[model samples]
Target: MQNIGKIVVVAAATLSLAACGQGAKTQAAAPAGPPVPPSSAAPAPQSKGRECAADDIKTTGKFGEKPTITIPDDCDPPKKLITKDLSEGTGNGAKAGQKLQMNYHLVTWSNKQVLDSSFDSKPFELNLGAGEVIPGWDQGLAGIKQGGRRLLIIPPDLAYGQGGRGIEPNETLVFVTDAVSVPAG
Candidate 1:
């Protein structure tokens, strides 16, 4: 009986660690968007894939599935954050301290394996400048308008660094995102 009890405790502990993104992620809260007020103006079209025109990474996927990414096998990570606009938007751009709903795809630069993507599930909500996400996100996401799509190529220093979640230590990360909404403060 004592041996069984120990086994159960160890199993529970391991499960707990895995639940914390084992270095992956947490289940995001339900999707929420800006409260739209009825108007006569037609809504602007949302941006989609156009990755290769802007950066070295290439991606293929629709709005609701995991995207496939292709990067040059020998390409090196840039020293600074690379924010490439895939498409433009007319809505208010994201800013610090505002709540935002965004669709994102994250892949590690080392092995080119996808780590996370909102396109697989509900759009992720982030409180800008709140430290809920990595520093690269807060800095790279700034100035992008709602309805815009962008590519953020974040170097290892701006990402998980040595204490990597599921990612390798000091891994650079690549993210393609659509700035869906920024609700009023």
Candidate 2:
């Protein structure tokens, strides 16, 4: 056993019981304490963002169901991404550079049609700021605790911009997500 501060590393010999050899475990055994080189410690994750201020965008419907979005006529989305946590989670908060799994639903600003949904498939895995997803999702979901439900309103710049993936040009996107896990740093 190794101790750093109050942490204890309970090192044990892991045995392979299967005939077929497995390559390796994805997750590493966490160190008993902080990194030996304190300078190498990862920076803390950004806290959950503030609630949306765009009065034009409104949501009406229960969670875990197809959400209904109401967009006021001639209304524009906020320049910055707006985020709101509908329900608190029960897991740890994530840090920068860490990967996470989430279930999400996305819709266009003009028409409230669901462009994509993870509810029909598996949870989407992404590393924070790793450029696997849109900037809004990366910035908005940062530091979000696991199992938490959050809503994000992303502007065109943060979304697809002039050329959208499946929607119109310069379209703003709305996302509702469930942060399933936020591993310890």
Candidate of highest lDDT: 1
**Tens digits of per-residue lDDT for model 2, 1-185:** 33653342222223333212343332245445323436774454233343336555676544455455665544455667888887777666666699998888888865667888887888889998888888888888987888777888998888887655786666778888888667866
For candidate 1, write residues 6-59 as lDDT tens digits: 999999998988877544543344434433436974454233333223357787
Model 1 local distance difference test score: 0.75
Q: CA lDDT of 64 in candidate 2? A: 55
TM-score for candidate 2, residues paired by index: 0.63
Error of 2 at 87 (Å): 1.1
Off by over 4 Å in 2: 1-56, 60-66
Q: Which regions of candidate 1 deviate over 4 angstroms?
A: 1-54, 61-66
- TM-score per candidate, chains pooled: 0.65, 0.63
